[model samples]
Target: KKVSEFIGKTTNNVAEYTALLRGLELSKEFNADEIEIKCDSKLMVNQLKKKWKVKSPNLKPLYQKVRLLLSAYRKVNLIHVPRSIIKAADKLVNKAINSSLDKDVEVHFVEEETESTLF
Candidate 1:
């Protein structure tokens, strides 16, 4: 499954963190024991992996939430990939943004498939 949510006027880091949090939630709901998380945001990935410090006060709570959710899984791999590798997600984000702007309402898109991959 793929999901996109329109959160208004937030910084890029906050958006990245929010996406991770949502992904973790979905994984938990599905009772997934192991998951691989891939994102184009290096800062978010590194922060989660403990390679870099989360210096922004705005991200502290988000970081903590992500960490808390992640503990339920038996194994989790956080990988940072180039943005080009995630064009489908980028398109969803653009769609969400456009829908929110045009309709003046919050946009949330969820596409389900027989085989699911969280994004």
Candidate 2:
């Protein structure tokens, strides 16, 4: 797992995309065959799905980067989640404003051997 934080002075939509881009980079670093992206921002989710058009120039490039990253995944699942379930990405945005909250920014490598039977 790899995480990155981008901060300060940007529109909500742009910040959402920046977080998303970083997420994608992390996914790739993790060697994910498929990706499940969860975001609390409805506008960002809608924009990625073409349900909403991006009119701001600041968002256009980010949108394109997202599109490109998505293309690399064999299967991509983008989900609109409640803020309650999206603390990590939310923290990324806040980390930009204040660096102290950026603990989630990490590059982790975990190897899975097999399934476990806890029952």
Candidate 3:
């Protein structure tokens, strides 16, 4: 499953945390017992794993929230990976960013019976 949204102006770290939160929520919904989270952000990975202290005031709460989410799973692993290995997620982020910038694009859905009318 994939999820994306415009979360307004925020730092890259904040955006990454938002994605993590959504992913965690979805995993719980899918009844996943074990989850392995791979992230390109070193700071985020370290903070979530308690390897590094959360020094940023803005990220402290987010870090705590992630820790709480981790407790819900039976087993969870947080891994830090290089950006090259995370290309697919990168593309999703890029697509979301580009779509947000191009507000002029419009999409409409039509009923199957009226397909000819849409044309």
Candidate 4:
């Protein structure tokens, strides 16, 4: 998040994007074989689904990455969740600078060899 500030990007929007990407990454780790993304940002939700075009250069790459990640999964969906229920993401977006959240990441896939249910 601090890096975004140094790069002259809106931390809120970047945090939102980071959260969305993290969700997609997690789905793959769970060996989900499918992915579903839920967000309160209508613009982001629609752009990833292609229901609307992304006119902002800032948002275009993120949208494209979501599409590519979706292809890696057997099935993927980008859906909207009402703001009332998306608490964690909201906090991430509205966090104060130098916040402790800098160490709290929701979706990371650095581990190797995930467990298999079939065993």
lDDT of 3 by residue, 1-119 (tens): 55667777789998898888877877887777677777788888767767689998888888788878888777776666677766667777776676665222222222111111100
After superposing candidate 1, which stretches have Cα over 4 Å from the reference? 101-119
Candidate 3: Cα lDDT at 49: 63
| Per-model TM against the reference | 0.79, 0.72, 0.78, 0.65
lDDT of 3: 0.69
For candidate 4, what is the TM-score? 0.65
Instruction: By TM-score, rank the candidates, best first.
Output: 1, 3, 2, 4
Distance from true location, Cα of 81 in model 3, Å = 1.6
Q: After TM-score superposition, what is the CA distance of residue 36 in candidate 3 from its true location, in Å?
A: 0.8
Tens-place lDDT per residue, model 2, 42-112, is: 78877877878989899999999988988877776766667755565555456565763445554322232
What would the per-residue lDDT of candidate 4 be over residues 5-107, giving only the tens digit for each residue? Answer: 1223464555566666765666665767766555677666666656789887877787678677777776665556667666654544545344543454342
Best by lDDT: 1
Q: What stretches of model 3 exceed 4 Å from their correct place?
A: 101-119
lDDT of each: 0.73, 0.67, 0.69, 0.56
Task: Give Cα distance to truth, residue 72, candidate 1, Å.
Answer: 0.7
For all predictions, the C-alpha RMSD in Å is: 6.5, 8.0, 13.5, 8.9
lDDT of 1 by residue, 23-101 (tens): 7887777888888776778788778878799999999999999988988877886666677766666776677565554
Flag clash pairs in model 1. Answer: none
Candidate 2 vs 3: which has more lDDT: 3
